[model samples]
Target chain A: MELGPHILLALLESAVSTAVLALTAIGLALVFGIMRVVNVAHGEFFMLGAVLAWWITDQLTAFSPAVGFAVALVLSPLLVGAIAYASDRIVINRVDYDPERTIVATVGLLYIFQQISLMTFGPDARPVEPPFNTRLAIPWLEITEQGWAVYWPWGLSITSYKLAVIAISIVLLIGVWLVLSKTRYGLIMRATQQDKDIAQAFGIRIERVYGLVFAAGGALAAMGAVLIVPIQQAHYLMGGDPLLLSFIVVILGGLGSLSGTLVAAAIIGLSNGMIAVFFSPTLAKILATLLVALVLIWRPAGLFTRSSR
Target chain B: MLELSGIAAAYGRVKVLHDVSLSVCEGEVVCVLGRNGAGKTSTMKAIMGLLPLSAGQITVDGTRLDTLPVDHVAKHRVAYTPQGRRLFPELTVRENLEIGLMARGEDSRVLDWVLELFPRLEERMNQLAHTLSGGEQQMAAIGRALCINPRFLLLDEPTEGLQPSIVALIQEVVSTLSKSGVGVLLVEQRIDAVLSIADKVAFIENGYSREVVPAATLKTDRSLLEKYVGV
Candidate 1:
């Protein structure tokens, strides 16, 4: 059997999924790393973005696909960030730092937000239809209307939009990395994350830093939602899968380590995708679960660790 | 420039420092010597605005520091090198100093002065604070506080767990700060080490301080140590 085409297709799909997975997981890793609060409501922010993207696409009526995509990308994250900021100040901040209480509070927020999505947008999975459909030809490897070369050597084809999803994910991830490493604000955030009492002693306003961190997580989740909506239809409960997967990525990468989150995201995405292709989707999920269990049993700090100084 | 009068404080319902009155003149080293639970740490905390004063006044140049919060107290030209050094363990030595100077806002001169005081800090500036030895961390903690260019520095047990050489080095730093006209309230357990450098010394027994005396008088008289502080 010719392995060339099969391998190429697998690699491409894995690459795309890996990028998307990284974006989704980075937010979870950051919030957990800094505040040490597990934000169960984080997934709702992604669902909010998907629902908003679908709504925006429907409302735009006459806009081009490019315009709709652009609007969704810009608007969703900011909207979700605002919601997160409000929630942080109003509810999460008031809970203090009791670990058990925070978990319950955020999980409650997740369900409440999920219900809000249902109430506002209804229960059906709404498809966000792109404005135009155009296909690009890559010789024998035919690409989709969305610029993804999704063809095997057996004349099988897939959508190019999925490739676009991968590309956008890479861009966002790099942006987050640059912001965290290069900016002055990012430095303060990292310092605050390490030790809140010391950070305040150093003259950093901790409450403000927390708000910014929550917003960063919310924005990333929202961006992930927009990236996936064209491929995965928008639904009230769409955030469930991403939320579960993000936890796995965060644990596999190590708590509060940024680079670890990215690596774990890739491992999770590629392995899950490959396993699902060879076996059943349920089997792939079980494998991911087993992998997490093994990681927890062996190295509870995850694959990579930040020096928690 | 730092003064605390009739200051009363507590942790929850348990009172720690009671009716404490102390002052450090500009360019003078004032040391508070006490055995454990004598409220030496509580006095420093009150001056740094970490503990809420149940009753009393804390003024840095008559600015009423006690009413203000911790961050605002730094703005009033007061800095604290807390006991245990409390350095940001995750950050590098330089980053620790940098964050400590954030409220100084628009002034890089203080940063330069701190670096100058501890040149070893410059060598290991990129290393994490936790990775540093006790001596280096003590220097970093002091350096971090000094980066605020405070008029008054509160050092709580700076030599608590340090080696003799490091303790001597810190004594020298306190002396230098005095020469530079920064008032210092040095809290210490080793009365002899502090007496050597302090202009005035006060003994805290239980939660109240004894009468303040000249360090010269306290140094010559071992009887006073026996009366107020004992092994």
Candidate 2:
């Protein structure tokens, strides 16, 4: 592969990762921003989604792979959302959403979710078959002896499933933006985020809103996991990387900022993909960590937030 | 009538309000006047259910309000504009008002009345609440409370930091609301502002409501203001 094709392939790969990261990180950011609760078990929700997708698809093997994939896509996130809502009501609400205690509680939740998955899903890494996947060769524009020429480059291709993931993610992101901006529920949620006391004074049942937000956050992570399950195998331990990456993205993007989360996801995702392709995955992670440290030292509010907050 | 009788409340282990009592009938404005830390704000909080009453009772037309939750109080057609003009800063002025309507599941019809009362807010409806000037923020806060179409309104220091013109505008709005049969319990430090709009003034001193007197009485006898408010 030539340098141009390699870079292009890396860019394509980065776009896929960026899409998934934005979905997952936005979940964490919403929970943190509204409830002021740092959900440490957010990644476990992703893991649970992947695990549930595998289970759902596996049980439906009598049907077509596409049918099973479609069912899993819809069912997994809803189940994850229910579990999250239950956890919020049973645990997070009981702790009064005290910042320090919620962290410890969510950490405990992370372990509980991991252990439960281990018990039911077992230790095996399972892959869900993509509903539809076909390799599509990408052509490169080259200046040849006859002037501009287009030729299909060897290995310069992308899977249809990966492209679908990108398209689906963009649609979902826009939908989320619309809901938060144009809907009455969105206005209430923003009010709750700004000041809980004032929100309560205005007759907003904040506890209900908190439960819904926590569930929504989990659902978003699950959706991301469901989308990526075909590419990445489901394992009890798969939650750790997404969790760490999301935390870095949320912090780097700016706490509670949706636009910041997207921008930071792109930066981190592209850099990670490019660096991993060019150098090593370990080196990419190290650079990301260094970037986070620099951000903390200089812009503690994150890259996109105003200083007043 | 909106009434608070012998209502006592505390912050943690410390008592802040002791035997504070007052009432406002329909189409009346009752102002609670007190010095700093005289439990004027705590009384408002207790009525709004933000602060739990250690004793006594708060009732609106014989409905026990003290037993209800903070959010539930607003559902009963009671609205509060707290100290510091606590608007949802990131949201637009329009959104802040709309949230008040959303609480009661009411439509935007009430918003027109609020805008009419604060025309300055109508001009800045699309602007973020935090970016607005102090007077505009106060207008937005009061406008938000009005959006609920409350039967009884509790306003804590609504004109505390506003300019003279804005304060006069607020006074006119309160009088208008009272004439429209809304009961208002206004906590204020500005005696002149309070005297102009308030039908009766309740003085609070050292965590206790000292006395309830007609605004006309206070105009002739200034000793009560000197004794309780030290103004």
Best-fitting candidate, scored by TM-score = 2
Report the lDDT of model 1 for residue A41: 88
Q: What clash pairs does model 2 have?
A: none
Question: Per-residue CA lDDT of candidate 1, range A1-309, in tens?
Answer: 145555555666677667777887899888898888899988888899899999888888687877987888899899999998888888778997456888999998899999999999999998886543344333344557877674435533345777678777888888888887777788798888876765665567777878888888998999988887877899998888889889999999998889989988988899888776667778978888898999899888988874233
Task: Give the alpha carbon lDDT tens digit for every residue of A28-100 in model 2.
Answer: 9999999999999999999999999999999999999999999999999999999999999999999999999
Per-residue lDDT tens digits of candidate 1, residues B54-172? 99898877779888656577777778888899887877898888777786773678878887788889998999898999999999999988988877888998998889999998898
- So what's the TM-score on candidate 1? 0.90
Worst 10 residues of 2 chain A by lDDT: A300-309
Q: Candidate 2's error at A124, in angstroms? A: 0.6
Model 2's chain B yields a TM-score of 0.97
**DockQ, structure candidate 1:** 0.53
Off by over 4 Å in 1: A1-4, A130-152, A155-159, A306-309, B6-19, B53-57, B163-165, B227-229
> Pairing residues by index, what is the TM-score of model 2?
0.97
